[model samples]
Target: MQEKLTINYTNDLHSYFENWPKIAGYLKGNKQKLQDAGETCWLVDIGDHVDRSRPIAEAFRGKANISLLNEAGYDFATIGNNEGITLDYDDLYHLYDEAEFRVAVANLHTKTGKDPSWMEPSWVVETTGGVKVGMIGLTAPFPDFYNLIGWDVQDPMEILKQEIGPLRSSCDVVVLLSHLGIYADRDIAAAFPEIDVIIGGHTHHLLHEGEYVNQCLITTAGKQGFYMGEVEIIWDTEQECITGKHARAIPVADLEDDADTAEQVAVYSENAAKAMHRPAVVLPDPMPCGPYEDSRAMDLLTDYLRRWTKADLAFLNAGVLLDSFPAGAVSYMDIHRICPHPINPATVPLTGESLEQIVNAALQPDFVSFPLKGFGFRGKVIGKMIYSGLTFDITGTEAKPVAKNLKIHGRPLDPKKLYTTAMADTFTFGSLLPNIKQAEGKKYFMPEMLRDLLLEAFQEIEK
Candidate 1:
């Protein structure tokens, strides 16, 4: 007789809770169908289920996400960058303390030469027909980010090599819950032929019908809980060796909502709304416009960054502040609404020539005014580039910079001198400016997001 196993998975949820009920509803219905037929089934998540971008996640530091996942019946899971490096040590330490599902991450260990008490490298589950299956989870190894947050992430390759060898002989099929993006997924498939399936996430690439690498079939459901993945394994019960595999991504948009799960979500949503309404600040009068120009709020934030980082200069995009200051009653909730991204303050060193190019590039008519999204930028538009510790004389109409002669700390720009400037990391990778891309010795400050800095800046303004 042939025994078939079904695995349903989601990846990169990032706290888009509005769609959670819908996805959970579908999973519940599917689980019942599989159970009634006496077939074996499992539900899993590849990682990134928690993100501070949402109020519920930000309030409880991902504890809410863990609870929600547990309520929805996640059987197994892994960690992604959002879950790995974004939270402080204590928060992460206790984040999964209450989780009911098995958390498998072979590559992660504690910084003090001990593993997290709740973490396991691998697990073996026996099927209804007594066939054993092995599973391992992996998170991305971004050491710099992890280090800042007081955690250490090991190399996935090294961990996989050590973990998979034992599973090869102990299990009929091996599955990998991978959060290392597509390149790493391909590499794992090539290097480890023993792994029968690779479920992936972290680049948000959608694989509708799955892809095969060597003997492994890989699948991903993309990001935002919009899709779910399925892996079907047909095993011969008697032989326990001969089998076939299939994987696919399933859309959940049209799926009916389960009433019970929907009720749970509504309760959580109401609680979150009430908690996020805490006060931030009280503005007696509205602050003037221009977050990038000479406006009060932008200038204040840029100056704060300069002083805080001790950089030679500081720059920021105006649109970082989303809404205008109303006449009165500015609260933490209001500030959060205006600046919701989980962006941190970063400083990069650049040469004087590179600085000129950066300034000039930022002043370009189309460049400064562009509406850019992604890369941790949740603002409306680029607006303008606000700078501190620098001065420039402009001569063009429409505020376009022309014949620019710039100075730093009352001195003219030196073509050969290196100056450390603080700026948002969003501009460091893209072609926003040559200087930003070519910056050297970049230092990123974590745990203290840009919004946190903004609140500090506002406090200073109030003082």
Candidate 2:
């Protein structure tokens, strides 16, 4: 006798609800047909299902995402960076409180290194024919963010080393739910031969027919529910071993959606909208956020950030604010709609010479108008650089402006003197701001995003 084990999964949804109904329908429909045909079906989510950029995810703090997963009949789920570090400690700890599915995270724990009751290191499923399959879930680690939010995330590789041997010995087939990106999955496949299948996410690469590396099958269905991943294992029940492995990504854009699921999502969205409608502040005047032009809102935001972080100077792009708040009672929904990036504030110490270089570079049209991606920016472009406690003259041509007569706190900048600077944490990563990226003594403020700061700043108008 033989058994067909179906592992269906989704990853990096990131609160893209427009495509979720179809995905949910596909997963549920396939599960019913497979199980009705006497096959074993296991549904899983590879994480990042909860993104604050969406009103439903933000308003309920992820409980709604759990309800959707439960409705879709997910058997297991893992954490991505969005699920792991974006939320506060308590929120992330209790995120899956009502999740009917098992939340498997092998490398994350509390600050005291205690495992949450909802977290499982691995999952073991026994098929009807008695073939056992094991799953080990691992998420990408951002130790600094996790630490700031009162959780400790260990290295995924080290945790894998500890858990793989045990999981391998206990089950006929082994699966890895990796939220560590495509390149990391390839490396894991080559490093861990015992891993029979690796279903991945994070970098959001799609493998239509799956990629085989070192006798291990690696598969992923990009991001935002564009495709659904399927991995099948042919289990020989008589021998109690897995004889074959196959994987494929199914496109679901034009697929039929479950009416009930769609209705439920609409209901959730409606409720979230109502919840987010709570008043943030009453604005006596309109505060426009013009990315390419000077905006009082951006200026005030920079000033608030500098004061909040207690830095000598601060600066951030005008584009951080996506829209304007008209004169009236602005709701939390309005704030989130306008400034939805899950970005944090940070302070970096730099010498005046380095600061001058960064200012000049930032003034460049390419840098200011860059359609930046990653590092947690959820906006269209960088826009104009708005400064607080600093001013300078641009003397060169409009095409290539050169910053001169730079002053910090009403005095000329000293080349050898170091100053504490406040900025969005996104600048600390990559080469967009090389001097800031290379600067020392960088401190990040977590849990609260830039939107939170804007909310507080908007209240000042009421006063």
Please report the candidate that would top lDDT against the real structure. 2
Q: On residues 43-115, what C-alpha lDDT tens digit does candidate 2 reach at each position?
A: 9999999999999999888889999999999999999999887888889888998989898888988977666
Over 4 Å off in model 2, which ranges? 236-243
Best TM-score goes to which candidate?
A: 2
- RMSD, each candidate, Å? 2.4, 1.6
Clashing pairs in 1: 279-332, 280-331, 280-332, 281-330
Give, for candidate 1, the lowest lDDT window spanning 10 residues.
287-296
Residue 386's lDDT within candidate 1 is 91
Model 1 Cα displacement at 186 (Å)?
Answer: 1.7
Query: lDDT by residue for model 1 over 231-317, one digit each (tens)?
Result: 999998777664788988888888888788788777776777788787777666777665455577788888998888899999988
> What would the TM-score be for candidate 1 when compared with the true structure?
0.93
Which ranges in model 1 have alpha carbons more than 4 Å from their true place?
288-294, 369-373, 394-403, 429-438
